[model samples]
Target chain A: MLHTVNKSPFERNSLDACLGLAKAGSAILLIEDGVVGAIKGTTIESKLTETMQSSKIYVLGPDLAARGLSEDKLVDGIQVVDYGGFVDLAAENTAVQSWL
Target chain B: MSEGTIKKFMYVNRKPPYGTVYALESLEVVLIGAAFDQDVSLAFIGDGVYQITKGQSTSDIGMKNFSPTYNALGDYDITKLYVEQESLTERGLSVDDLMDIVYEDEDDDWAEKPSIRVVSRAELADVIAGQDILLNF
Candidate 1:
């Protein structure tokens, strides 16, 4: 399954909640304000790094740019994708779970 | 569509309308997704129950009132609308306070049937467990 988290970790615990319920091998795509978690040197950076060990982590490219975050600011190994890539992830996965 | 497999898609609306754009944008996604001919369902829980409340007038708020769009879901063959009973009661709302949404069933000779199903929180949990895809807003 592909889990999309749209809330910022600073505003809510949705990312942690999603990580708790997401199974191994499931993909996590951060969009909207959720891209804040992908920034390097943030408090959640280590948590996101640990999460990538069990599941692939992705951040929406447009959302990142919209927030004025450059690609280099993202944590290592966090893949960035566009809207088409978002659609492709949904099609590739058997299901999608969005954590608002 | 194609002979490809169809997955159960559920849109979970947990926020109220107007205060944020999530509710409206979620509706747009549902409308666009209707073209895929997938098994789609809308689940209203928490503040989401307010989205379908009747007498919604956004004229004073300077925003286009999109509440009526829920009425058009049946036409798109996206008629599985579930309202969590607990959520409504907590907000002091009843089914009577919601919009009257119905669909014409061709199998039943075009007879009109209610599209919204009021379910208990437990029942809604079961419904969530059965969904192949869940889009939360």
Candidate 2:
């Protein structure tokens, strides 16, 4: 399944949605202001990491690089995906759900 | 599974790149989709057009200007990049001032290949209906 999560407030209510829905073969695509969760060392990353422990959760690389967050700034385990990769992921999943 | 049967998604970008991270982040999701061989399209509307303005150098902001990577869309098998015509004029940008990439038009041979389409603001309805899915960034 494909879950499109773009809400910027990932640490609050939305976090649960992201975690609960992600399952084997599922992926979370973080868009919009949600890229803030891409930061590695923050408190939220720990939770995000645990929530997505068995799933593929992606943060837009272009969004991160555009906003000035670099690969170095990204905490461990967070993958910075490029535009091309995003399309491929969307194609692979059987379902695409957006958590606006 | 049939290739064309899958959902093709277009990201509606309406926010500025910095104040909000939607523009950049959405691009990431698109990449993921592409990795899975999905069809993805991108449209810039409102402040999101700010993402492709010319002469964007984010060095002083302590970050890299992502506008250049827009050129790399082809490398990732991502085409169908669209820019709203109304947004261009509102932002004081003419198509001539925009980034150098494939422009999608009905006459173009884009149907034969992965490509980007430049649409007018008025044409968004068609774009919305044409997609199997719609994502707003």
Clashes of each: 0, 35
lDDT of 1 by residue, B1-110 (tens): 77889999999998666656888999999999999999999999876776787666554335677888898998999878999998766544578868888988988898
Candidate with top DockQ is 2
Model 1: how far residue A83 lies from native, Å = 40
lDDT of 2 by residue, A1-100 (tens): 8777765542245656766767865788776556656666444566666756677778877665544445665556667677787888889987788786
Question: Which DockQ values do the candidates obtain, in the order shown?
Answer: 0.02, 0.05
Q: List candidate 2 segments past 4 Å from native.
A: A1-100, B1-4, B102-116
**Model 1, span A31-98: residue lDDT tens:** 86677578776667788888899899999876555433568767899999988989999999999999
TM-score of chain B of each: 0.97, 0.80
TM-score of each: 0.58, 0.50
